[model samples]
Target: MFQLGKTIVSEDIIEKEFVCNLSACKGACCIEGDAGAPLEENEAKILDDIYSKVKPFLRPEGIKAIEQQGTWIKSDFGELETPLINDAECAYVIFDKKGTALCAIEEAYNKGIVDWKKPVSCHLYPVRVKDFSEFASVNYHKWEICDDACTLGKELQVPIYKFVKEALIRKFGQHWYAELEKVAEKNN
Candidate 1:
């Protein structure tokens, strides 16, 4: 790991390649996870404030889950996160006609119904951030489900950092991302 500003970033992000091959994975990350998507405290409040607008884009089961569980819930571990349906799929998960899971909140954002796209955590998949007292730990998350994505990324020659460039910028900022690029260049 190398330090960038207040973050300790893993070299795997620069070494490994990954691009979401949704056709192969079918958005399993949303529906297959045991826990709901992680959220920040502010994201919870945003969910609460925008539920009504996002509700229409959700599946019936997702809506029911959110309505019964509230916009967000404190996990048994005390982390703030989105709710789940039947303890499986995320409460905000909708699906395209092909049955690939998608975030309802993001659907709303895509339709111009809301300003927020989705939770930063959700936006930054395969790159999980753990905030500490001083620095944030940024690491690539390797999941078996995303093996196809890894293969595709390798074929496309896209590193994980490049694939998630927009999200890294969103989470860290332009200057921080630029520094990361310099570090990536040096590593390469």
Candidate 2:
């Protein structure tokens, strides 16, 4: 692991490759996860604020879950997450014509209905961040469901850092990402 500013980043972020192959995985990450998408403290409020706008884009099951459970729910572990449908698919999930799950919140964002792009956690998939008083731990999440993504990323030569560049910049600042790039360059 290496430190970039206050964040402790895992070496796997640079060593591993992963590009979401939606066709191969059919966005199983959205549908098959036991827990809902992780949400930041503020994201829950945003969901409540934008629920009406995002509701139209979601499936009936998702809408029902949100209405019954509220926009976000506290997990047994005390982390905030989107509510789930039957403890399976995320409540904010909407399927594309190709039957791949997508984020309705993001669909609203793309249509300019909401300014916040889904949750930062969803945006930074395959990379989970845990915050502490002094710093944050950033680690690559190795999931069997993403094996096809790993293979495709290897084929395309896209490292995890590169694939999640925008998210890193969003969570950390641009300067932090620049420093991380320097570290990656030196390591490579």
In candidate 2, where is summed lDDT lowest over 10 consecutive residues? Answer: 30-39
Cα distance off (Å), candidate 1, residue 43: 0.6
lDDT of each: 0.93, 0.93
For candidate 1, write residues 17-71 as lDDT tens digits.
9999999999999988789888988898898899899888988998888889999
Clashing pairs in 2: none
Model 1: lDDT equals 0.93
Question: Model 2 segments beyond 4 Å from truth?
Answer: none
User: Each model's TM-score, in the order given?
Assistant: 0.98, 0.98
Q: Compute the lDDT of residue 29 as modeled in candidate 2.
A: 91
TM-score for candidate 1, please give it. Answer: 0.98
**Segments of candidate 1 deviating more than 4 angstroms:** none
Q: TM-score for model 2?
A: 0.98
